[model samples]
Target: MVINTGLANLNRYNLNFIIIFFYYAAIYGTIAVFEENMMIRSIKDIILLVISFITLFIIIFKKQQKDLFVLFVLFLFYIPIIIIPYMFLNLSEQSLLYGLKITILPIVMLFTGILLSNFIKKDKILNCFKGIFFIITATWLIQYFLGIEKLLNFGYEYGINVKHFYGYLRLPSTIGTPDGYAILLAFLSIIIERNIKNKKIKILFFIVSMVFILSSTIRSAIMYWLVAYITLFFLRVLTSRTKFIIYSSLLLIFVPIFLFIMSKVNNSLFSIHSLEDRLSHWNLIEFDPFSTKGIIGSGLGSVGASSVKLEEINRSLNGYAVDNQFLAIYYQIGILGIIIFLLIIFYILYVFFKKRSKGQLGIIIIIGTIVSCLFTNTLEIYPYNLYFWFYLGILIDEPELIETEY
Candidate 1:
């Protein structure tokens, strides 16, 4: 791909303006925190909704194609799938609201990406993203060295306590937690690598980002980075024999060795205990709509992090945080919601594969998202979801016949 740094000549898209919402969302991990301040939380939600509607209006105004229409239909169909049961199940008001936020946020983010794709040239978007990436990474680095997170008031307010792993402070930077920081930066790093023109510079950036990822001690981020790199490698190498050899090595040798190392680390990054906790959460098959709740779920916000907070206010709920996004859907939305959600993913992946050439970077980034979603609620949660959907919009919103110009 060609690196287009000649931003001066390109038509103005000012699409970079949208980054503020994502920046704020991811920087603070507000949805996970800020439970005490309803006013602040409400403001954040309103900002997201407004931005989404504005982007949706742009997509409609610009004359959307069948693909966009299909997305629209899916978005429409999905609401009732969650909402209908939410109402009928007589779930707590908090659950309903939380459900709506997660459901609507991604759709809005999708539209936002579509809008950006239609107006801004890809090169410009990449150019602007580099600026954002550098700023965020630098801020994170500064926060780490200074032993302070108060650079942003909200950052200090909602931030998780600084964690120490391997005798170094686990840097959450402005994002509140190490896992949260790593997840967002991991995705952004892919975009940065795609955008940066110099190979040495790109590798340096990768090293720096990996430092943060490792220091943070978020095992899922490490797993995501490894899986994405290996997948990217497989995609780049063409020979079947080479592919087979690599696969055999990874499966037969590398994975077992890696697992052994993880076992020894006391599950520092991804421990057996961590795996057990995740499995225990998934063991809530009894709560499955097919098994219990029927067509609708207990309610929207009833299952995950939001449920934990809502539970305080409404003690009647058996709200437990489900680490897995897919299972979270089943527990909160029910059988039909889970099925519809899965179908949506299948359809999106099908579309992604069909247009793989047009959005190779996007495809690779999404593969990471798919893997991360299984282990973490990053996609369903805020800030993380913000970047996930926004980047996703940029990736899949390709114009037909749009091939990489480079």
Candidate 2:
């Protein structure tokens, strides 16, 4: 049984290498072509994550071996269960309704990955982006035909796309915008993570991805990528190779400091707005926690009574939707909601990094995505959700077993 299990794992590992190549083909290369396929864009990460979870539960029973932090995820996800329904009953609103659409993907995806940890093998995520040249070239051509490049540079208004939050246009390209595409590259690193043999590949991936992020001219995207990359670099120095504890410690310190500085710096080089507007957006608009909602919240899509009407929540915030996920979530779920959301993040990072798992790439990508999302609403969109889960599917299994057992 032991030998058979080992062989099966090896077989799956080899297959994953092939699967990942096509995965990134859709992610980095295809551009708007992937978007052309509406059904593809519609698929959510939660679906594959669910599959991964079921696959793992039946295989390893690695439940006992799962790191302490990840072990808590099962229960943490349920926090929304109580809050979502409660708000619906009390608030007489749709806050919970919209919030549900936004969060359900992550909750389902993460849960599936957690549940199926055993049978699934952790894959180095490289093959995912293997066909980048072909896919990207093809998509760029299509964009050319559609005049998307011109359309994007100037405005989303011309095309079917719409500009939202902070006066930025939204693209539905292969993986999406500068942040979306760049983060995908960063996330793709999860597959090549930490292996001395593939360090070049991973570093190169980071650089190329950053370039795409820059093209967006979105200060938030640039800042988020910078912070995540810098954090990863510094964390690498302190880490003792596979030293999980050191990695986590450094990440915690670096992230908050980086975010705070970005949030505050007045003469911040290359930021999106002038000093006055930036400050007003970041500091002045204090995240008004709906007092009445208390811990539970106003309801998934419930409306608020103060400042800006709850119905006009997205528009009143500056004729744009909330760019910050933390604030967006807080508004929907309240303080308890924020607390629950954060705890999940803390736990996931703890579990993900601790295994000294081949998730170094995944961690970086997640951090990059998180930082980028702070500035752009990547979480609420389509292909972004689909791509995030695909990356996640690679993250749930154990890479050690795949490499060693094979």
Candidate 3:
């Protein structure tokens, strides 16, 4: 079963296809079955755990990768314990069910192994991830063409209305929610950017990603994507504090004021209910100094605030959770736990920002993603976080592991 990959390029071994297929199957397939009641969440959990750990163990014990591999596994185990409390928290039976996300362990671990395998060959790794991204895009388009992507949204006032076909097609493209997909696809422009080889290709790619985003109708994600894209695209503008301050004052400050004035004059013309919900949800944060739950907070998945919020939102019309990552982590782990979670994320960001050698733009997108998740809940979902870790682990690993000072 062993094969030699002496050259360490994708052509040497076809692991890219394997990784891509498993990734989408697990992510989207699980989503398709999640609501259908066919596959037990526990079964997918177990299979991924087996595949993930088996891959990690083989890599770690193998002669070529003992130290780095072991350290990597430990790193994976160490950080996510931030999420382990829901099992014991004092919460309702239904609230406790939310802890099923611990199942995310296997998926993260599986990607971890992919990271370990990919470190030896960075291009293959990137290619594989890009391939998976395209798989999602391709499959979605296929479904769209078949008319299967069509579904209706039950409007509270207007009954069921035709909805744009997007994520949740086959794989739970949850993060790829109409807006979320746009953001990822827009970022994909950075992924596929070549050596400034051809002008037409770049313009075409940019246009296509934009088309995807605009049609998605996720205003929040779209706004975020546009802002992040502009910032990263002309990063040189931020190279100096004076320049950043000047630009921020003029663009950031005036743009909002102008938009506000226009929206007021136009009666806030294009408001989406989802945006209203997000704005309304901000009150829940309210810089609440008074902690609701004490240490160990309302039992990991207990009914403290989230259930109340759900009742309020009516399970986002059976969506079952908030769209804010910060809230999601905080509700489950409490403020202290969220701090730990952010610290882990901050560590990754710090590394990327400090070491701009590893494709700085990609790192920017990665960090931007983490930052964006704080305002919205994408990490709690699979695939996004899984892909984040996979890309990040390899990007960081592409360079030699720096030795620590004694």
Over 255-311, each residue of candidate 1 has an lDDT whose tens digit, in order, gives 788678756864566546777878876876555355547567666777776676576
lDDT of 3 by residue, 1-406 (tens): 1344542453224355436534654355425433435355345545555556655665566554433444455456534443445455433555544443432342354345344554355555556656666765675464455543233211111111123322322211323334335455545545554322467776786677665555555454455556655656446456688877887677777778967874675432255665577768656543442455433344443332335434544542222355566665555556665555556555556655666543455455655666566446645434444555555555554433321111
Q: Which number leads on TM-score?
A: 1
Q: TM-score, each model? A: 0.80, 0.61, 0.65
Of 1 and 3, the candidate ahead on lDDT is 1
lDDT of 2 by residue, 136-212 (tens): 43553455456545755644333233233344433434544444443444443333334425656657755555544
| lDDT at 352, model 1 | 75
Q: Which ten residues in a row have the lowest lDDT in candidate 1?
A: 1-10
Each candidate's clash count:
2, 28, 11
The candidates, ranked best first by TM-score, are: 1, 3, 2
lDDT of prediction 3: 0.48
C-alpha lDDT values of all predictions: 0.65, 0.49, 0.48
Roughly what TM-score does model 2 have, to 2 decimal places?
0.61
Off by over 4 Å in 2: 1-98, 114-125, 132-146, 149-172, 176-179, 189-207, 239-271, 274-290, 301-320, 356-359, 385-406
